[model samples]
Target: MAPVFAHGQLRLYLLSLLNEGPRHGYEIMRDLEQRFNGLYTPSAGTVYPRLAKLEEEGLVSRSDDGRKATYTITAAGRDEVARRQLDLGDLQSDLDRSASQLAEEVRSRVKGEAADLRAELKAAAREARRVARPAGEPMSGRAGSEFERQINELRSSARKLVRSRRTSEAVRAEALRIVREAQQRIDDLS
Candidate 1:
């Protein structure tokens, strides 16, 4: 994605920066990185297209000075900048909330499937043992080894499930913290 969306609400800052004075593309990118303390030092490639999109959206305009083209904000762009804090918070909140719910749903489904697989494995093992047993072929040793191997596989699968669940939880937690605390900080600044 372009820095416009990756930086999320920072695009408003670009509009705000333009409100101060007309600036070239590099200037806008530099100012944003400075303002955010390098949280997002946008690349020229990303910023230029984003600027073009903003211009296409009627949020900004440009002028040529025989060298670098300077960009300026329109009234619509100013309104957009003014509303940035609230809109950004809402977007983050919605996204994080959705992630949290989805993580929980995945965790529940995996747990249910694990239970079903355990039952099926036990039934299959039982049926196999009952139906086949060569006379004095020493099936007991083979069955014991197979049982151990299957149990190890189950254990390995459970560990992977645990790791996946924990990783998702960690991501959801970070998103929630950003949505809650970062929103408040931006609101205070605005």
Candidate 2:
């Protein structure tokens, strides 16, 4: 997928951020991530080098404050940002659209999954009711008990994963593996 910021766009955007006020490298990174709604975060390697280049060009000045380097945009940086104010506005609009689109996609998928699960549960309940049963006897037995338990567990795990704001790649891969395994198990039963 294409990156959110185009070439040279990041440089200009960083200049615009620094134009806000002095900020340390990590602070700048977090600010950028926040602006993208956690969908995009530039790594330290990507950001520090750009800051260094800006410093070299005298577009920004850096001061060491006890193990932390804070960068302040120079007059030239402010001028550049001012010159491209419209471009900065456009960048903000693009980022807002990207974030909104991502959020909407996630919501739609979650709703679809919930609907599917509800349908499956209803079908299972109907099938259980159709099976022969003694009067006044509640649904209980080894028959389909294991399957129900597994489905419940899977549902709980999925809910937990979805509720989390962030998850590592390993966790996400594990979730996918679990889902695939559950589907395979269901297919095997059929």
The candidate that wins on lDDT is 2
- Each model's lDDT: 0.62, 0.74
**What local lDDT score does residue 130 receive in model 1, on the 0 to 100 scale?**
45
* Candidate 1 residue-wise lDDT, 1-190, digit = tens: 1122434444655676787888999898887566544434678886888788889999999888788898999999888877685775665565455445554665675456555544544554454444444555554676657756654664565455446644345344433443344346434543
What lDDT tens digits, residue by residue, belong to model 2 across residues 32-121? 889867767889999999999999999999999999999999999899899998999898787777778766665566556555555554
Clashes of 1: 0
In candidate 1, which residue pairs clash? none
Per-candidate RMSD vs. true structure? Answer: 15.7, 8.0
- List residue ranges in candidate 2 displaced over 4 A: 112-141, 144-190
Can you give the TM-score per candidate against the true fold?
0.40, 0.62
